[model samples]
Target: MGRWVLHLPVALPRRVDAVVLVVALRDSLGHVPALDFGEATVSAEDDQSRRTRVWCDARLGGGQRCELPLAHDGGCR
Candidate 1:
């Protein structure tokens, strides 16, 4: 399939709330092979193009990537 973005609007007024929702959604949908949780991000409603990644997403090796939080300390998973 080609690349595409799915925008799900959250009416919550806080960034933390929105981030939590997205993380929850990712966990629930983790079973889908087509979904790349590492690529997950959140952006302000006024600027959807400017994204803040939720995960470190650093390339580890052999088609694998770091699954830790973006600002996580210690080694990447």
Candidate 2:
């Protein structure tokens, strides 16, 4: 199955900062089983090329998603 996309309007001007904020929010709300933090990504308006992934989001055993950063070295958790 494919993943869903959500566009959130943030007040920050920089993409890096926006990603940081997003990761922080996801981590703080980690207890929420409904939130898929691994699939989180940030992008400029209407720019698919600039779409930056905030997490690895790789599928693991036991139906779990990787919580590491995008393109992270080593193994997924």
Candidate 3:
């Protein structure tokens, strides 16, 4: 298995609430596998240094229009 990185933008209203990362993978057959943000150092900065890292299991899909859902853990299961 390989690893994939996903960066998401923090919403304004949700900034007050903690947000976890969600990584979704889709292929020609549609959504197959995905992962949630377990370990991260999320920050609310616009600079490159302030970025959250979301790890996902590769070999899922690298095709076009791959749906990626980003949300808090237990929020999207």
Candidate 4:
């Protein structure tokens, strides 16, 4: 189990209905794991910076499931 704090910078259109943040995790076998984090909503007013906290569980059968120095993919929708 590990905790990660990410600071994200978001830019929104002048006129938009809604914005969302998406995060995805993959394991060593290129398999998507059961992630504890979900999509987060971003308001138009939140144009500057956003702070996100994530918890990851890399344990699998008493060993590490994912590769070392894990990389995360995050995007705004």
Candidate 5:
């Protein structure tokens, strides 16, 4: 298994907008690999330190749905 990082940038709340997360993967051939998108959760804390945590429990394979958290580092409850 390889390591991948997902980055999200959004304006501080109290502003009306939508967060967009694009999930993509590349193969060994340096091409967009067929992703087997599975069930996952992205969470952030409600307290001061908005540390985001992501949890993935499903088998992945080419493309997947983006599950964004409502807060940062609240421990994926």
Candidate 6:
């Protein structure tokens, strides 16, 4: 197995109730029928700098994770 770290910076207009990181297999039909791996309630932090940090971890090729700042509208602004 290979080790890797993925970081994704997501900026949203509003904060969501929950953020999930998912890993799945996509077929030729472009359909993700199921999630090969899933993680929830990652890491969300507010630096008081108008930004929230959300992040998670998985195996190689699993997916990307990030930390985001909190916004006023429930979503990342």
RMSD of 6: 12.1
RMSD of each: 1.8, 3.3, 10.0, 11.7, 9.8, 12.1
Q: Using Cα atoms with residue i matched to residue i, what is each candidate's TM-score against the true structure? A: 0.80, 0.74, 0.29, 0.26, 0.21, 0.25
lDDT of 5 by residue, 14-76 (tens): 222222232322122224343332322233324425432332322233533334334434333
Q: Backbone collision count in every prediction?
A: 0, 0, 0, 0, 13, 15
**Cα distance off (Å), candidate 2, residue 60:** 1.3
**CA displacement after TM-score superposition, residue 71 of candidate 4 (Å):** 31
User: Which digits, one per residue and each the tens of the lDDT, describe model 3 over residues 28-58?
Assistant: 3233345333333345655548655442222
Distance (Å) between predicted and true CA of 64, model 5?
Answer: 7.9
**lDDT value for model 5:** 0.34
Task: State which candidate has the highest TM-score.
Answer: 1
Model 2's alpha-carbon lDDT is 0.79
Q: In candidate 4, residue 20 scores what lDDT?
A: 21
- Give the best candidate by lDDT: 1
- The stretch of ten residues in a row with the least summed lDDT in candidate 2 is 3-12
**CA lDDT, candidate 2, residue 10:** 71
lDDT of 4 by residue, 1-77 (tens): 99775535456564232222233322232343444233233444554355332322345555444322223454221
Least accurate 10 contiguous residues by lDDT in model 6: 21-30
Quickly count the clashes in candidate 6: 15
Model 4: lowest-lDDT 10 consecutive positions = 17-26
Model 6 agreement with the true structure over 1-77: per-residue lDDT tens digits: 97564444444333453343222111232254342222223233453335333322222344542223222233321
Pick by lDDT: 1 or 3, better one: 1
User: What lDDT score is found at residue 55 in candidate 4?
Assistant: 25
Between candidates 5 and 6, the TM-score winner: 6
- lDDT score for residue 73 of model 6: 33
